[model samples]
Target: MRRTARRAGKALGAGAAAALLALATPAGTAQAADGVLSIDGTEHEDPSGCFPLGDFAPPKIANLTDGTAWIWSGPSCDGQVTQQIDPGTSAIGRGRSLYIE
Candidate 1:
């Protein structure tokens, strides 16, 4: 009975650790910025994931949200990253996509 109790305690500890790690790790689209991402002066509120910028890629961008924004050269944010705009920051770079994280 004592050994069984010990095993149960170990399992509980491990499970707790796993749960903590999961909480600490970033879940896809789970958390989002509480602000907006401005593209060419247009604000996109509560943006999540990748925002594609088709042929008319905006040259000026402003990250007014509390998240990091990545400017990608290719559509769907698959290619090179043109700029990294942080929270409350702005940049002058043209890109085909914008990823807010």
Candidate 2:
């Protein structure tokens, strides 16, 4: 019984250490949310890219580029296009697709 208790204690200690490490590190592998689109809770570093809206159901958050960006209401850069997304301008609505050049 004593040996079993000692093993359980060591396991608990290791688990606590791992939990602390995870909390200290960043959550995702994306760049900072400064100048990129945060699609489906993931930030894309590049200013230009095609992200399928279908991949992120109920698309939540997004961040505009430094210069300018265009947002589309449909996937594949289709549908209504909202122009002039300036710096520090966060895309409030859930755009079906985002195109920045």
Candidate 1 lDDT tens digits, 8-57: 99999999999999999876646788898888877889877888766764
- Tell me the lDDT of model 1 at 7: 100
What TM-score against the true fold does each predicted structure earn? 0.64, 0.47
Query: Residue 78 of candidate 1: its Cα lDDT?
Result: 79
Give candidate 1 regions above 4 Å deviation.
Answer: 1-29
User: Which residue pairs overlap in candidate 2's backbone?
Assistant: none
Q: Tell me the whole-model lDDT of each prediction, alpha carbons only.
A: 0.84, 0.65
Per-residue lDDT of model 2, residues 45-92, tens digit only: 755655565634546545555645566778888888854356666544
